[model samples]
Target: MLPIQPSPRRKAIAAWFQDRLAWDSVREFIAHKTVPVHSGTIWYAFGGITLFLFVIQVVTGILLLVYYRPTPSEAYESVQFIVTRVAFGWLIRSIHIWSANLLILSAFVHMISVAFLHAYRKPRELVWLSGIVLLALALGFGFSGYLLPWNTISFFATKVGTDMATFIPWMGSTVGRYLRGGDAVGGATLTRFFGFHVAVLPALTSLFLLFHLGLVQKFGISTPPWVEKRSRGAGTRPPQMPFFPDFFLHELMVWYGALALLGILAAVFPWELGQKADAFASAPAGIRPEWYFLAPFYTLKLIPGHVAGMEGEVVGLLGFGLLAFWWAALPFWGARPDGTVRSKLVTGGAVAFLAYLSTFSLLGYLR
Candidate 1:
């Protein structure tokens, strides 16, 4: 016997949804969209890569949350049981951890590529700013989730990180207390971080992501300066491929590759739980924040005790503040007829900053 099909009533409801949703308009938009083919085509996929990792984080995080406990006393114990007892729990947790790191990494590369391609000119400024916000949220996710396991390393690292916030110019102490929920990292801090990690950050991220994509759809993808200049000289538009099948199919291939890598990493080096946090006990030596935080962490550690009568941490914090301000204001800086940064100095400075980041991060890890 053949399987029963949907009743007339169900078919009518489905047709109503299709009409209400305006599937025809969506199809029209996709039909008109095209992806540019050039040397820069590969860089276009970095956005898709970041998005893929984000979806992975969402799925795995929900699974982990089903078994996780937020209180200090039970947080570590719950995670321990999930990994050791629950079916495929270790793999889910490991994938979450590894993909979170990769998400940030992919976002960084995507932003840097945008900068090099000068994609932030004029109309794309909001896109760049939105992306910067997303990067900050990704870091926030890392910081908040670090404290979730309530492990020894995470405990001390949060203390150090929150302590650094105290160097903020005006609301230093207030901010530190706000982040930790008290004088130090404790039960309150665990609960606060867990709330931000699972609830607050995700909500903000979703809104910003929607706005960013809406702007991208409105403005369309940017062509690099060189590519645009060449096309103009040739008196012809650049080659284009259909967005639906061509570009999206390429994205699927990259996603498959990333998924394979995540599986291998999850299997080969499963995430491990360190000793449970002890607020009163001594923290182990060499405790450090996550890798992204290392450069600033070691910068503070290496600063002189006093710089022109100012506290080292204060000085370091001010210097980093200036650096961050410059990065944030990039969209408005060096505006021209074409609104692109043509200064060699700007490029040199970016290269120098990357070098500084790499050197200090390596030193921090080694120390």
Candidate 2:
């Protein structure tokens, strides 16, 4: 049988794009790349899921921005208008809020999966560091965006959060001033946080995300130690599936599932637009920051006001700083000089950390 050939117009168009874009190289790369297939492979989807949620966040955020006024005088009213007046605006805002929460949750899962799978060992150190930075930026997005509505709860929560910043020793006051754009949370703080949520954080996250993805591409997927050891013991190679169709299609399905969950949450329980912030009013009792920040927030609450002549808040902040340093530098201490991971120690630490976060977050939410 004779083969079908492209028409002259189609051929010309293809040639034009191939000349300008050189997309063939990308196709070639995709065709050749493969993902290691194993029990832990499913965990890799969380990274893609996080990215998907981020894209959702950007789209919904842009839609909300059309009607959002950054000034405290108008912020609450503007949000009210979006939820009540604009068509499906409530759903859009809800999805944005829910997706932001899910994005952080997915990032945490991805990080924990990496730790458990020992994917951060050796040459992938930069990847792990970049991921940590990206996660931090995700948290920054949450903290900054939480106050955009300028509601009473958010107002007081941000006030407490910025106050905690003042416990950072040398740079605490500076950071607090920078974040508030003054000594207190007010119109300036709302405007400043708006800039951060929309502009500063997105820019930083984009850079770190690109770096992390590039490193992942360069190193390919890491096979867990157990997987590799099993293959070696059995005298067989670890199996893999082509990235183009097999793994990519699986990832697409997972993204669809996430979208479905997001829609259900947004539709069933729309995000609240609380009362407008009254700067003169007393702070509400039991007001707290978002769930992600609840762990440390609750911990700080339990500490005595003064600890051994130092402010308890300061002591808590210092302890958190040390723990953060240890977590971020996991690649350094996690693996031994002989290129073997301290799997038991790392696993134990991760379990303990997760327990602390979950328990404190629940307590903070309840009390």
Candidate 3:
């Protein structure tokens, strides 16, 4: 066999790249003052757990794509083929679904923990905002993916979801029409959503993840509420450790634990496809979104019917208006060290409302 070797110029370029990557400056930048001073709280693990599960979802989703189809006629059959014929395909699909659920759940817990601890203040505002974006995009992924199954429940759910978009005012109907690719959900809508679920959103998510982690390393992880003064005195140097081998090692362990938990869930309750889509069939009893969406679904249901001149949909438009206002105001609201009394009130009300909604959803499931 002929010798395999790079040209001298190529070898020189490779060495330069390696040397740049291994530079002490980059190491110092990433490690900064990060320390292994562990608090040993399981709650701290949630962020890493969420990141790990998102990676897993991406991998397993790619595997499933090998056999899955997005077209109306072929979608259900393709999924069935993956589940029943492909080697360990069921396991891959189950893992993808379970990991997605865990990712969202852990992100929620992490966000709440960060909020209560006031970790979103000042230097960490962007980090928190990036996390909020991630959460929103993750939910978008769920919504788009839900329609890909093309089953009866998914069909109606998509119909209801897109129809709600039409409530947005003058632009609402236009956007809804564009999203549905016409007056109704059909072939073009499926194609657009499938592309977004598998491609566009994931690409944006990766960019946001980079920005979030960069901000994290730039500003040290926020300490818990109970821990103050990081050391003996305000001016005294705090005990510290390296990020490469110590703090990140803990993240690895936490990631492993999250994977184990996801494994158990997938094994226990692998996702089942509902009946093949009947375009003319009546909507199923008790149609509900995935768990992460139940709170929003309940919110839409609970909103009073009159706002502005419109009745049935005006309330929804106003609710969405409020949501946009909140997102726009987050950076300013999070700038205050105290997180504002009004912010507290709003967050508290949200938490309470979600809890109540979740309880009801569980009850419905039980019944």
Candidate 4:
């Protein structure tokens, strides 16, 4: 004997919304939208902005690919064609570049905010770990894209970058060789990078993002800084707003705003293609990396040279390996009984170091 369900009128209305219109969930959630006290600040906006920029990158990257030729000979010319002939091509490329910068910026801000507020503790640790992985991949995305223009800067930069890897104690040369796909940075290197920049990395990023977002939802928003003592009723509840309508409306606004900002940047200062990469050309002046890379560049700069028989390069390489190892093992390491305050302090210290290095780099640039 089954219990009687709702009246047919009520069932029809529910079906109409759940099946046809997608607004039913939004309505239900809004009826329960008791705003969290801690989430009403500007810091919360950055995560939304980060997601919006990623969407822009995907769309603009796909558009650029439509005109891009990944071969050695045709690559430069195809990019030139995009610059000159394609409709709003400069705008699209500019948006791609600017959005990438914005994405990195927002992600860093979001991470720092989460760290300061102890949002990465306990159940939320996986989300934080996933974010760190995403950050590394984002850097790789920039590294791979940097070489695509095949210009003097990109060429020398790639050489310097790969050479840095080769400075590792045991596996450096092997890794460098694998990256180059040959004796030096040649056509094969370009082709490999093209696949990495446009394909492999993007696919991985998409997959991780699905898990990252799902984990975030599962854990719910990290309570804002002010919520010192969370009781059962203090945190966000399960019947939250549907991501499709209520949340997505905000997402849509952010996306449009980011696009407009990118448009203005493109119109003001379109990206320039530097001299075509010559294996023999002299290095260009001010050989700084893209903005996002300044932190690592600074890290490599900051580490003191020569520890115990090892050269500065070796020490730096070892330090990088340790950092990456820690990042990979963080889920397990976090499982240990370290206090939340200690974790926050460690994260803060690393961020501060990066900030110090970045400031120095900018001053060096200005000088």
Best by TM-score: 2
Expressed as tens digits, the lDDT of each residue in 1-367 for candidate 3 is 9999899999888789878787667757765656424353445568888888888988999898899888888988999898889988888988888888888888888877776565676667789889988888988888898888788878888888898888877788898987888898887788889999999999999999999988887787776433445554565554456666776787798888788888888888889988888777898887887876665566667667765566756676676668656653555664455543245654675576457657856654544
Best by lDDT: 2
- Write candidate 4's Cα lDDT for 1-367 as tens digits: 9998899999888888788878867687555543233444445567778877888888999999999887767777787788889998888887788778878888888776766566677777778888988888888888888788787888887887888888877888898998888879978889889899988999999988998988876666666434544443576442334454565676677668877887788789888877788887788777777776665566676667776877888887777777667645544554446534455545666576567657866754554
The lDDT of each candidate is 0.89, 0.94, 0.77, 0.75
TM-score attained by model 3: 0.84
lDDT of prediction 2: 0.94
Q: Residue-wise lDDT of candidate 2 within 58-165, one digit each (tens)?
A: 999999999999998899999999999999999999999999999999999999999999999999999999999999999989999999999999999899889889
lDDT of 4 at 322: 79
Ten contiguous residues minimizing lDDT sum, candidate 1: 334-343
TM-score of each: 0.94, 0.97, 0.84, 0.81
Order the candidate numbers by lDDT, best to worst.
2, 1, 3, 4
Better of 1 and 3 by lDDT: 1
Better of 3 and 4 by lDDT: 3
In candidate 1, which residue pairs get closer than 3 Å at backbone N, Cα or C atoms, i.e. clash? none
Q: Which ten residues in a row have the lowest lDDT in candidate 2?
A: 282-291
Clashing pairs in 3: 35-241
Alpha-carbon RMSD to native, per candidate: 3.6, 1.4, 5.7, 5.7
